[model samples]
Target: MNKVIIDEDIVLKGEHLSIVFGGLKAVEDFNIEIKKGELVGLIGPNGAGKTTAFNLLTGVYKPTSGNIYLNGTNVSRLSPHKRVAKGIARTFQNIRLFKKLSVLDNVKIACNSNMKYSPLTAIFRLPNFWKEEKELDRKAKDILAVFGLNEVEEEYAVNLPYGKQRKLEIARAIATDPKIILLDEPAAGMNPTETEELMETIKIVKEKYDVSILLIEHDMKLVMGICERIIVLNYGKIIASGIPEEIQSNKTVITAYLGEEVE
Candidate 1:
């Protein structure tokens, strides 16, 4: 009956998080704490509730029971938009981009959420609105440049290679200026070469943007390489929580992946 004890320096903390869908429990007694500036991984087999947890955190689905806190503020009741304003943003496992929009415009659209200019002023083309728009354009461009996407800024997102499209998703998430980013399978469909490049890009994003990340990835190699800590889930609950090496050697994690060793 021993439970995993979390460290106290928690930036994003969830307590007894559970989600029940019509008498079926999708997530049960789930808990996690993401410390400031820490890059952590959430790993699990299919149906382990990794994506479900992300949905609860981002307000896509409300938890049936639990508390979600961000930077010491209770955020369980906040709407998705309000959560973004409170510094939480996430990218989906599937690529979701404005396919018709240029790369720069996609990034710019994310920035619009934080823009201070009033719509009335923008519609009227006021001097103040113009100034704010200029500032936002500059900031969006700077963020795109960090991801090495400035070169393709004017190109349509649908035309970019698969890897660049993934990068653009990350860039858009960052453009929201979130303190915590949830990346769900950032390297899902990439070749090894693309994954390697993406690994580097993820590291760069962490350092340059000064944001903590919670990654949900199935690629063991990528997860082991970049994550400072790893949380393994099975059957909608955490089975093992430790550093990469510890996770690699954990008996519970091994059994979860390989099934219990037959007697």
Candidate 2:
């Protein structure tokens, strides 16, 4: 039970967060803070409650206890859609895309969450609706170009390569224009080269958009290379949290990963 010093410039804060399903406790006494514009990593072995914690933060599931705050505002009561509108967006561990929709359209759909036009106006093709539609399309195209997916703008999402699909998912999330983005295993199924490219893309995205990132990655190399800070979870609770060098040498973290007490 080593105590790790947490910084105070937190943009997203979880206070005593916990979640339970029936009689099984998934996450307990979870507390973490993500600083503004910082790239942080959340890592642990499978079933460590990493994804469950993610669900609580993103409003996919209500917390059984504790609270979540974004920019000092209590957002625990907000719905998923409202959370997105309030500058929080997330990508799934499994890629979720509309297979029949083109890459451009998939990204466009993310932007539609905040669309200004009413359904009646859009259905009737009113002048204001048409104007807003055009603007949305233009913005979506711009986002695709930023991700180097403009070439495949017309290609169906299901037709893209696996790595490209991953990138497209990120592009779609970014299209929502959120201040904080949660990415679950962004480099899960990529080769070294593709992972390297994704690392660069992530860095560029954070710098250019000024967005804070919370990443869950099992790839040690990728996590150590990209994340400024790392939090390690085990058995539904945080065991260690620190910078890369500190985490590498931490006794509790080493034991958690290696399955034996560190001397």
Instruction: Tell me the lDDT of model 1 at 89.
Output: 90
Q: Give lDDT tens digits, candidate 2, residues 155-211.
A: 999999988899999998899998889999988899999989988999998998889
In the range 83-137, model 1's lDDT, one tens digit per residue, is 8998999999999999999999999999999888888999999998989889989
Where model 2 places Cα greater than 4 Å from the true spot, the runs are: 1-9, 260-263
Compare the candidates by lDDT and give the number of the best one: 1
Worst 10-residue lDDT window for candidate 1 reads 1-10
Error of 1 at 78 (Å): 0.6
Q: Report model 1's TM-score to 2 decimal places.
A: 0.94
Alpha-carbon TM-score of each model against the true structure:
0.94, 0.93
The alpha-carbon lDDT assigned to residue 11 of candidate 2 equals: 73
Candidate 1: misplaced stretches above 4 Å? 1-9, 260-263
